[model samples]
Target: MAAGHYGLSNLIAIVDHNGLQIDGTNEEVMDLHPLDAKWSSFGWHVLMVDGHDHEALLDAYQEAEKQDRPVVLIANTVKGKGVSYMENQVEWHGKAPSDAELVQALKELGGDPS
Candidate 1:
């Protein structure tokens, strides 16, 4: 609100919209649906994009640069993306992976486990 009131066109904020928080899913905790509308109501220029797509993210930044007010990029992404076991599992939020889990996760991502 303050940013919009003061017209902070230079400000750019990025939000990782993974739909999960430390406790649980957003819907299970506090529902903040119509997120774009909420931000727009605050007089911000909102850009929605796939969080995993590098090209889409770059494009969003470029678009934000052309806006005349504060801009926010909402990046839609999956929690623990690419790792099957951890993906969207709330327990993974604050827990560190075990040594074996780390190796498996690395393999799943095609990264060298060494």
Candidate 2:
């Protein structure tokens, strides 16, 4: 709100809405929380999309750049995204991944072992 009114047209804010905060599920504390609506209500151009999708991310960014006001991209991300056991699991939030899990996660994100 302040940014838009301040004439910061090029400002952009992207938040990873994985519903997993530091302690517990975001829903548990902020039940039925609508990130998009909240930001849009605050006069921000809001975009919602899967954070894991590269194409969607690119498209959203392009669209945001076209907005005259600040844009808040509410990306639906998965905490510990690529790891099987960590995906969408709140326990993984702020927790360090095991060495094995890190290796697997890197591979999943297309990081070559070499």
For model 1, what is the C-alpha lDDT against the true structure?
0.94
41 in model 1: Cα distance from truth in Å? Answer: 1.1
Collision pairs in model 2 = none
Q: Given candidate 1, what's the lDDT at residue 88?
A: 88
lDDT of 2 by residue, 1-114 (tens): 788667466988989878877668877767647677877777788888898899999999899899888898888887876667788787777778778878888888789755
lDDT of 1 by residue, 37-106 (tens): 9999999999999999999999999999999999999999989999999998888888999999999999
Please identify model 2 stretches exceeding 4 Å from their true place: 107-114
Looking at model 1, which ten-residue stretch has the lowest summed lDDT?
Answer: 86-95
Taking all chains together, the TM-score of candidate 1 against the true structure is: 0.94
TM-score (all chains, Cα) for each model: 0.94, 0.83
